[model samples]
Target: MAKYKIKINPKNLPVFDKYWHYQKSVQSPDIDVKFFRKAYKEIFDKHAVLLREDFCGTFKLCCEWVKLRERHEAIGLDLDPEPLAYGKENYYPKLNSKEKDRLVTSEQNVLTAKLKKPSDVTVAVNFSYFIFKERQVLKEYFQNVYDNLGDQGLFLLDIFGGSDIFDLPEEETEFEDENFSYYWDQEDYNPILNHGLFHIHFKRKGEKKRKNVFNYDWRVWSIAEVRDILTEVGFAETRCYWEGTDKDGEGDGEFKPSEKGEAHCESFVAYVAGIKK
Candidate 1:
């Protein structure tokens, strides 16, 4: 056997930033803030000033919310310190003084944290609430949200489902311009319990793929079940906003309040708003 040595260049090495990659692939906080404002206005015929983000990993949405308007204020609550610290270091410095004054992040659990003032709008997006695998636990969390909201508050949640959600195969998406790829890997699913294990992987150009950069152990809850739980938690009314499809049958990213949803699609994403009167 011939002996061989490989030369490694530090300058050429890629910086594998999991949070940066996750933000690129998963989050659209700017657009989401606008949507939240529009949805709140449409439902209540008034602009919302305060937003509470639950399970707010990295709290990017809270930072964006304050920047959306002069009067807007936001609070982000999450139990995890790692993402909170990331937000403080990466996203916090980008905000203006006024925006910084309006935005706050707390290391607190959504199920038990107490808010000094009730929020006009609260969101648990990115399906973060799916972490609660049991129906009772989910309901308890919803009740907590209900209790933390103002008299005319709105609770918004994003959900995804379809025929192919269960037993979903690992899917890879390439960002050619960014020179990286993102992978959604579904490790396992239990149909009876609707519980699933999922992971996110990333691969930089000319580098080996990074496995399990992020992982999720969640119970897939249906829109109907979520609505029922909201009702049980004392929300006066619940509404579904279904996404519109493009000419090619892909999601067009325009969501509208819909009485009915397309059921035959292999995958779908929608929002459910719970109104507290």
Candidate 2:
């Protein structure tokens, strides 16, 4: 019998697109939009139509929001042009003509942008507001949101913390099916200031690890502090949604409004809703 060998083509291999990988590993925009809509309805007993996404890096949630309802509209505000452009190139094309018409993006600072219309709901997720380390600055941003919302509007924000988050220097998640791994690196943390430096790294199969693809310098604000600030910013009411644990003692991804949260959780994620009356 003759010996035979198989040949491989470079074009057949998957291209390394960092944004694609980041979305797959970090974001669940489809679910997030549903949560936002549900939370709004639960509080106000009416459907929300317009949403504003702040620090919306690619605005994936905005795209998902419009897809949820024919009447829905979304405006994404971000200071960085790079991600905004990427979203236009990649995510925008996926929408139909009508859906495309309902979505908008602006390369402007969330703090200073003049919104022409009031939003039914506004969101700052992924702890993006943590970039505002100062209490007064964050309050100013919250006040901006409060002012931009329509009557009975809602503002939602996601926050994360736990004992393990501070102690863990780095954590890696492998996507075996995708042939890549994602890393969350905690480079430094200041106890006195409550400031932390974090980075996201990715490694494709058979490739060397890429470091610091995304960097975040943040002040880790507690849930109580965030609620207090929301109250200070003139939100009529503030609510907390705590994540439930699964049978395996891991986060189950279901967040329900709760007055008290688990005190001894090693790592946890939750949302804060500020409502304007």
Candidate 3:
């Protein structure tokens, strides 16, 4: 066997280490909670309350969202049931009755899911909407979101791309603390349509490297394409919140609205907000 420049943690830990160790540790729910509050209060002056998380795998954010207020309610919709069960076992158990009562998880497709009442804030983070590879399909999903919004509501989602994102074969990231190196393998990319295949692998020090821990076949949609779709969906206005990097040139986990961004290393993340009419 040969070794690459990276190693991934195998997630063999008996107690469901994949979500907590890999996803939750790196994910910043504090940032999410903050943005949801700011974006809501900024628009409706503390009137927004109900939140819907589309493609809410595991609904981790939903668990955190309800904690923001006793009155706050969250609805998480996703096609997959595994993560939802895991959230029930791990995150849901940790919350009190009132908090747990405020959260709702539905195992349904996001495109077809219906909200009893219009949501004040709805989000599709981690670029989950990338599953829709075609422009029309993506626009329909955005339109669904727009229709599901309350008066003065907001639709938010994250997008990331750079010169490096396209035309790249593979890239590796090393995390020494966890004794693993994460790989963002860009197996293929199409310049004509900006579609691609991506995989995540992990290598543990002195252990056999794990390949394809997770795989994603995404469209690699651009900011312009997404912005255009939001407008087509009849959103009154749209905004992009670019991320700031720290002194070490790593994502500082902070996002602020901006019109322009500078180029960066292998990968990056940011949010696109659509204001409902």
Candidate 4:
């Protein structure tokens, strides 16, 4: 009797395209559209006529912001040219003539980027500002936003936390019809240094998962710390909004005002708003 060997064959495996997988695995412009509209109206009691999106990758929000109203105009700023190009090719072409004229983007640093005047609202989402670890540096960024705001303007940022972030890996919510899965890889955590390293990975159902598609070096800043810095940087009022959980004890994607927070398991998302004086 001959011994049989089991072989892993590449020809039989599903081919996962990097860019295609990323495009299909992530993105929900409608959610940002809803959040931006609600957030803008919350601050101004009316739809914001102008918006500035800092550190905008692909600028899905900016495109949606412009489509919300005829008078609405949006400026998206990002350092990388790749996502900018992707937005131009994929998202921009999908816009109408009027919306196209209303939406404009530039490749630049968030610190130096400025709008015509202080916009009605300026947003920094995706926790991109975590790159600034130092308090003073973060304050400087917020102060710039304070200086660039129109009267009664608001600066919005989203933050994530939970005890589980100390040193652990987590999976992202899976979307139907998408053939990939996302992973948040937390490699190390330093309580003293407040340093954390994270990576984004993707897995296709029938293929081996791809690792480290994107990596980040960020400091997990607390809400208190962020609020303190925002106030010190010249914001008149800083408010934190806690996310609401459904009966299943999962986030419902709706965030409401809450100054006080309760301790939860390994994860949470919150919004921090700073009112420009």
TM-score of each candidate? Answer: 0.95, 0.94, 0.87, 0.88
* lDDT tens digits, residue span 1-277, model 3: 1111123447744432455544633466656977878877876676568899998877889988998887889999988777787777767888899998889998888877788888999999888899999888888898888888987889999998877776676766787887777776888888887888887777777767678777789998878789889998899998888889899888787788889888555666888999985
**Best of the two (1, 3) by lDDT:** 1
Query: Per-residue lDDT of 81-183 in model 1, one digit per residue for the tens?
Result: 8788888888988999999999988889899878999999999989999999999999999999999999999999999888877657799999999999999
The digit string of per-residue lDDT tens for model 2 on 96-163 reads: 99999999998888888778899999999889999999999999899999999999899999999988
* Candidate 4 lDDT tens digits, 165-232: 87576667464477557777888888897889888888777767778888889999998999999889
Report each candidate's C-alpha RMSD, comma-separated, in the order given.
Answer: 6.1, 6.8, 5.9, 7.8
Clash count list over all predictions: 0, 0, 5, 0
Comparing candidate 2 with candidate 3, which one achieves the higher lDDT? 2
TM-score of 2: 0.94
Clashing pairs in 1: none
The candidate 2 region of ten consecutive residues with least summed lDDT is 1-10
Q: Ten residues in a row with the worst lDDT in model 3?
A: 1-10
**Candidates 2 and 3: which is better by TM-score?**
2
Clash pairs (backbone) in predicted model 3? 7-181, 7-202, 7-203, 8-202, 8-203
TM-score between candidate 3 and the true structure: 0.87
A best-first ranking of the candidates according to their TM-score comes to: 1, 2, 4, 3
Model 3 lDDT, full chain set: 0.80
